[model samples]
Target: MHLLEGVAAILVSVCIYAWAYGKHHGPGAPGWAKGQLFASLISVLLVALFPVGAGFVALGLTEAMTPASWAGLVALAVLPVAIWKAVPRLARRA
Candidate 1:
């Protein structure tokens, strides 16, 4: 189960990273592009450990030991920048 999650996270992060790479180090939104690259890298690590939250819960452990929570936490931390940059293009398409 953990392996599957790790693989999925790796694939998702890699694909997004590949797409985001085009924006990074380019004549584009520097902060937004950098965030995507950074978020993707962090997400790969976080997502793999996301299930750690469930483990903590099962073991009556605190959230402090739950690495899974950081997956969404990190995503939330970076989401605004990505959305801020993408909304314009997304809105134009819609």
Candidate 2:
């Protein structure tokens, strides 16, 4: 169960981070990118901190799930992919 929770949490976190990365750094993102990013961060934090929060509740059922730790793992999983996808486009603009 612990392992499943960890995996689910990681997957969810990665998806959220990827969405945020695309929204902020992708081409033609809105002018309010900072606001959107802030909101996303807050949402992630809430999930990590509140067990009853949607993210927490979803991840809690899986194995090896701990709110803060899983969040970090998810970030680790997503950041590289997001950067890989975004950096090339950004460079072309440069």
Candidate 3:
């Protein structure tokens, strides 16, 4: 049960981050995109680092997570963005 919940939280955080990242990053984007990108990065990082406690703070039925779990969450959280930056896009000339 705990593992499943932790996975879910990480997934949700990454998905939300991806949505915000896609919205802010692209061709012909607005000038404020950098700010948006920064905010989105911070947003995901916080959620990933404090998955359970974040929810428990409001609901008050959860316990805090350990440091190792936080590291794992960080890895999961950054994987998508890392791949995005590392992989090449289609139909593009460099």
Q: Write the per-residue lDDT of candidate 1 for residues 1-94, one digit (tens) a residue.
A: 3323333343344444445455554565358656765767656655654455334333332235245545544554565565557544432311
| lDDT for position 14 in model 1 | 44
Cα displacement (angstroms), candidate 2, residue 79, comes to 15
Better of 1 and 2 by lDDT: 2
Per-candidate RMSD vs. true structure?
11.1, 8.4, 8.8
- Best model per lDDT: 2
Evaluate residue 63 in candidate 3 and report its C-alpha lDDT on the 0 to 100 scale. 34
lDDT of 3 by residue, 1-94 (tens): 3433454455555555555455456665456755856776768676655567345332322435566456545655665675466333421222
Q: What lDDT score belongs to each candidate, Candidate 1 first?
A: 0.47, 0.54, 0.51
Model 3 Cα shift for residue 56 (angstroms): 11
State model 3's lDDT.
0.51
Best by TM-score: 2
Per-residue lDDT tens digits for candidate 2, residues 37-72, read 677775766477434333543554444656755665
For all predicted structures, in order, the TM-scores are 0.30, 0.41, 0.37
